[model samples]
Each structure stands twice: as structure tokens, then as C-alpha cells.
Target: MESMNESNLTALAAFNHNEALTKIPTFLFLVLLTPFGIIGNAGVIYVYGCRLKKTNLQHFITLLAVFDIVCCLVAFPLKMVELWLPVMYPSGNLCKVQNSIICFTCVASALTLLIISVDRYKKVCRPTQSQMTLCHAKILFSVITVISLIYSVTAAFIYDRRSIPLDSDGYLVGYTCVMDFNSVVTQGYFLALFVVLVIVLGTMLVLYCLVWKEAKKHFMQSDLRYRHSENQEDGEDHTSPHKRNLHRTNRTVVLISLLFAISFVPSLLVSVLFAQFTHVQFSMTTRTIRELIYGTWALNSSMNPLVYGFCNENFRTEFQNLRIPFGCYGRYPAPKKNDIKSIAQV
Candidate 1:
């Protein structure tokens, strides 16, 4: 029994050594993802921060995008370093800091999405209820801020570097700021947090479904009323504007739903898998799969800009105009005197 245990430990060490050496491909892949993520997420922040006036929904999404960008910036570059220079890298303290930031930002993003869903639910399902006021938005923001700070500090302290015996080799292996999953406190905390995240995400999904159903029902009824009104006017153009606006709103909602799913689902799945399968050893085969999962999660940072540009008419117009050169802008027709006068009258 002693011999078998020694052999197993020897094999695991060899596996880790081999895995550490072959990280070039992973590094190069991250090099590709990082720039796109930075550019796209920055664009999202600019759009929400500069163009849109401050509102509860916009505030939540703007901050969420900011957190996503911060997480990618803090975590992905270190991940590349860990991949490329696994041996020479001194991640003793950096790992703890980066991991904590990642965790906090990820939790903040999830909470923001939950808030957005609840807001939509109230707006659609219970429209009679008062809209979320500025005070309410501020309180929610403060709560998220406090929770994220507490989580980051706690995780950073708990996940310090440790030295453990390796096999019977009489030598110690030093782990640098990686979570000690075997520790009782670590396991318990993770289990509880995982359950909370699952419940929050599940609630968001259910609420979104309810919002969609309610929106559909209300839209159909509104369409019917508009059609009846038009019919009373001998099928004239009374309903055209209403129908156009409804179509635009529906399109926006569908796009937002798709973006949310694309951005979040991969990370959520990876988290659940990690929680459930604690004993799954990291191997060459699993390395690529793990990188892919992280890469997919990183893509969310890029997807936000695309979603905004495609779904929001105002954003699309702004993006197009911003892309044009000054010379090109000069070539466009200026407003006529009568048009300026009419605008002033309005």
C-alpha cells in the first residue's frame, strides 16, 4: 500500500511538470483574445458613460461592463504569464490578488444581471408599480459595492501560499496562492457561495422568462387595440407608428437576452463543473478544454459592444458617425435655415 501511494504521487508530479512546460499555445491564444476584449469593453463603457443619460438600468449595465473589463484586465494577462512562464513565474502574492479581483468582479457581474432582470420584471409584469428611483439605484449600487469588497478581502486572505509535503521525497512543494480545496473552511465557503450563485442565476433566468411572456401578452393586446382604432378610421395610418415602435422594442429585448446568455452561460457552467468535480486532475487533455472555457468567458467582454451597436439605434448611429473622418463629416449637408428655425421653435 505504501509503494502504491508513492507511485501515484510520483505520477501526479510528473503530470504537473509536463503541464507546466507546454503552455505556449495557451499564451498565444490569450494574446489574441485580450486585445479584442479590451477594445470592445472600452467601447461599451464609452457608449453608456458618454452617450446615455444616467438611469438605473443604464447605470447597472455600465458598471457591469466596467467590472467585466477590470476582471479581464487583471486576470487574463496573469493567466498568460502563468501559462508561458509557469516555472519562472513568482505568483506567490499576485495570484491571490488577481484571483480575488476575478472573483469579486464575476460576482458583481452576476448581481448586476440579477438587478437588470428584476427591473425588467417590475417594468413589464407590474407596470403599475413605481419605477426604480434614483435613491433605490444608489442603494443597490452601495450594496453591491460592499458585498464585492468583503468577498475579495476574504478570498485573498484565505487563499495564501502554503507548503506541503510531496510524496515521500522529503522535499516540500510550494503552492502559490491557489485555493486549497481540501481545507475545511475553503470547501465550506465555496460550497455556500456556489449555491448562492446558482440560485441567483436561476432566479434571473426565471424572471426573464416571465418578463418575456408578459411583454408578449401586453404587446398582442396593444396591437389588437391599435388595429381596432385603425379599423374605426377606415383602416387608415393610425397604427403604423405604434407597430413600428413595438417591433423596435421587441428586437431590443431579444438582442439583450441573447447577449446575456452568450456572455454569462459559459462561465456559469465552468463554475458549476469546478464545484462538482473537485477531484478532476488537470492534465494535458483537460488543459485545452479549461482554456477554452475561460476563453469563452473572456469573449463576453467583447460581445457587449456588438450587442449595443446592433440593438440600440442611438448607439449604432453614434458608432457610425464616430467612425467617420472629419473630412467626411464636412462633406455632409448642413441644416437649412428653415430646419434650424423649426428646431428652435420646438
Candidate 2:
């Protein structure tokens, strides 16, 4: 750090502030995965979105894939270019444009996950409650779209491709994309985002508790039924088909929920820290750890389809039926429309 003209000092301070961050490899690793995530998440959207009929759950899942697609295609690539370029011009508006997409996709995905959990809670714990319809899903989607757009609009105002001056004479040199945290508006915007995270996480926690309680009650009733029916049949597997389906669905949901918590909690916490403590010291190792933890969000997007396929029976069945290139696959079971809908509902 060196003393210089006010304007030069301001820009140089910002440059060196983020300079140590470049030493972190986690950011670059994600940059490299941009292509893989785009391809994989797009494939997920195609497989799930194209075949599934209009249903609330399917709509929400498809929306998740869509958000992941946008992040991989739009946000991640922009970030990749920013990291790769040796020098960016302030005129390019890199930070604002790229971060705007980041804010939109990340917040939209979080809200969508909250919606999915709420839908599940309703179905599991409050079966008498009115079911979510396709139209309702559409309205929810529209609201989130508008909300994310409005929230992310702040990014465009708060970030910039800042030019760094080299010497006291203010010779032009290189520039970097950074958030203009000096603005009161930027801090306020981030504080708002922190509140949003708290609300989403709280909703998820409440829904999870309700679902768990309902699952326990169902398990007890199912055990009683099985015990009562066992006296009629000798050495029969008392588990019914419907119970098996519910068990499978519950297992899948539990796995996804655990993964969601693993991926997003750290990111949300770091975001709050950034909002409240912008001037905190940064080391290569510390920032690297943060990047690695937060990068789970990106990994989660592509991992979702795989998690579903591995944990859910229906997804495995559908995946097996997926057409192979050049028709190398043998005969496949074509699930009936009702069967697919049942799986989607699960």
C-alpha cells in the first residue's frame, strides 16, 4: 500500500484488496468446470423437463434445472472470462453484468428449493391441504422471476470494472472487476440478501420438521398394519407396494435435503459476513477455503440429477430407458403416462 492522490489511492486500494484472491485455485477450478456444468445441467433439464407432464413438483424441479442452466450458460461463463482475461476495461462493465446474473440465478434457486420443500411438507404432513396445481406453480415462478430480477438489479448499480492507477502521476495500467462496496446502497442491498437467506433457511427448517414428524407417524401406522397383517400370512414380506414407494420417496427426499444443507449453508453464512464485514483481512488460504466451500453451490446444480438417479427408483428406471446413441441399447420398458406422473408426484 502506498500513499497517492485521493482518486489513485482509492482505485489502487481496491485493486490490491482483491489481488490476494487471485492466488486461490478454487475459483479457477470452478471456472474450468463451466463447460461441464452447462452440458450436464442442460442434459438434466432435457431429460426431466421434456418427458414430465405439467405438475407442480415437476415444474419446480424443471425450474431448478433451468436456474442451473442459466448459471452454467450465462453466469459461470462470464466469470470464467473475467478470471482468464489479463486486463479488463472499466468500460466493459464486467462486474455488474456478471454478478447480476449470479445474484439472479443463486437467489432464484434458493427460493425454488424452499418452494419444493414447502410442497413436500404439504403433501406429507397436511394431505388435507389444497394441492399445488400447475397454475399455482406458474404464478410462483412468475413472482420469483420478478423478485430475482428486481433484487439482482442492485448488482448492476454496485459493481464495476474498476481501473487501477499505477503511480503518483496516475499512469493508466490494468483494471479489475470488483464490487463498489463504498456505496451505501451496495451494503444495504447485501443486508437485504442476508435477510432473504434467513427467511429461506427458516422455512426449510420448519418444513423439514413437519415432514419428519409426519414420516414418523406414518411409519408407526405402517408398522402396526404390517404386524396385524402378518398373523394372516406365514413368512410373507409384509411391506406393501405403496409403502415401498413412499419409503423410496422419503429416502430420496432425505438425501437431497442433506445435500442442500451441506451446499448452501456455508455460502449463505459467507454472504452475510461479506455484507457486514467488508474490510476483513484476506489470506490466500482463507479465501481459498471460502471459495471451495461456496463453490459447492455450483457443484450442487450438476449433482442434483445424479443424486436423483442414484437415490430414486423411478429416476433409475427412466435413466435406463434413455435412448442410447446409434440405438445400441436393447429393449426398454416404456413407462406408462400414469407411471411417470406417479413418480413425479413422489
Global lDDT scores for all candidate models = 0.63, 0.69
Deviating ranges (above 4 Å) for candidate 1: 1-26, 161-177, 225-283, 323-346
Q: What tens-digit string does per-residue lDDT give for candidate 2 at 300-328?
A: 55566666677666766765556643322
lDDT of 1 by residue, 104-143 (tens): 8756766776777787778778989888886898899889
| Candidate of highest TM-score | 2
TM-score of each: 0.74, 0.79
User: Between which residue pairs do clashes occur in model 1?
Assistant: none
RMSD of 2: 5.6
Lowest lDDT 10-residue stretch of candidate 1: 337-346
For every candidate, C-alpha RMSD to the true structure in Å: 7.4, 5.6
